[model samples]
Target: MLPSDPAAVELVTCGKIEIEGRLVDASNATLFCGISAEGVDAKCVYKPVSGERALWDFPDGTLAGREVASYLLSEAAGLHLVPPTVYRDGPFGPGMVQLWVDTKDGDDLVDVVAPRDVPAGWRRVLRAMDRFGDPAVLTHSDHPDVCLLAALDIVLNNADRKGGHVLHGTDGRVYGVDHGICLHAEPKLRTVLWGWVGERLPDEAVEALRTLRTAVRGPLGSALAEHLTRAELRALQRRLTDLLADPVFPTPSADWRAIPWPAF
Candidate 1:
């Protein structure tokens, strides 16, 4: 059984989605949907059930809770991230739901434009970076302006980052989805955003960080105090400190050194 928190939102099983027969996905849990949530809709992801043993051996409720937390934190930091649907026990156990994006087609910047070609979509991505300008805008990567959030994700130990994780909507804006791995306290940062290292954090991004840092010390921090432990909250403050101290390419700590080995 997964850990129970009265705060967790109870999600009823809306229905079941069968993927390849061996595995079944439950989409009725909430507003979120996985890639296989519908036949031929690629925007969804296969959200793992709360107690099901599968790819990652993380504790139950860990993924769902962190996704929610990551969304809230990213919002506070002024970064784009996937928000998860709150889930509690249903017929099958605790489960979180999320909207899916079709990663196979339009969302992929890789196939449409070659690395040599930073197409309009990717150019806009770069532009969004300039617009947000919040150095505290952590993702997963660590190389300054490159994959700023990606570096942040690496620090937070985010798993499940695929080419499709980033989506370019018809509105011409880029949105990130899937933040199941975060707030680990330990260093688990991993991502693929080292393309532009050594650049300065956008001015606006810095201001956003400053705002969040201050907020965390006040009402916002007090509100979160209920959701997170003192240690986890301190780690967040420390991350902000690290970013401010070295806004240009902040590196992970030595004790938490060593990237995960190649998938071979």
Candidate 2:
């Protein structure tokens, strides 16, 4: 279970953790379990700068900061889709430390549904072949949380939003993770949450975007300015303005790849 108090959780995250083990499936992550002075025990995912692989598009050693920035954006927008994340000096150097979400039955929304058996409310984006030549369908949850997630991704310029990045928390919330590849200055919105593309934005969603637009110039902007380049931050602000003005989900563009590889 996660700590009820955000402060307690933050304190635990800032404190030292006993490295449980490295998650082999994770390209760049470490698992740690720790207890704070206040006796708050927590598990966290730690992404060390040293473990990060250099990417052609993104600057080296900046992925950890991007993770923290994603969390900040989620909090500022009142989406709360991302788990609590912070950047601090760790044993391996400066990196991102995020509260580990205890998933329900280890089943994410993506894992529970079969392409052919997609529920009435969900929408399938495309059909493709899996590694073994099996048929597969890419889909997204049609729930409001997913709509907010897509909007958040647009604002962050997220380039790698694979299905596995969306998790169902034991606390009865949906959480998005692995935002190290987000916040690029260029257009790089890729995700499975395009089910509502071209649909008119709901009133609540419009209001949320507007709120984010105002916040970006204040504390939100100041906080992100530290992690992202001026160009990147400006791009984010522009996205907010565009979304607020259009108030519609955008269709996939032919100019860039719309989905990440290994969709699930």
Highest TM-score: give the candidate number: 2
Q: Looking at candidate 2, what is the lDDT of residue 194?
A: 79
lDDT of candidate 1 over 1-264, digit per residue (tens): 011212111211233433322223322123333233223332223344544333343444456656656655556666544432333333345554444432234334322222344543232112112234532212222222335455445334554444445555443334455566556565555433433346666665666567667777887777556445677778878877776676664443456423332200
Clashes of each: 37, 0
What TM-score does structure 2 among the candidates reach?
0.92
lDDT of 2 at 32: 62
Candidate 2: clashing pairs of residues: none
Q: Report how far off residue 171 is in candidate 1 (Å).
A: 3.1
Model 2 C-alpha lDDT per residue in residues 44-106, reported as the tens digit of each score: 777888899888999999999999899888887777889888888776777888877778774
Q: Stretches of candidate 2 above 4 Å error?
A: 111-115, 130-134
Please give the range of 10 consecutive residues that has the lowest summed lDDT in model 2.
1-10
What root-mean-square deviation over C-alphas does model 1 reach?
10.4
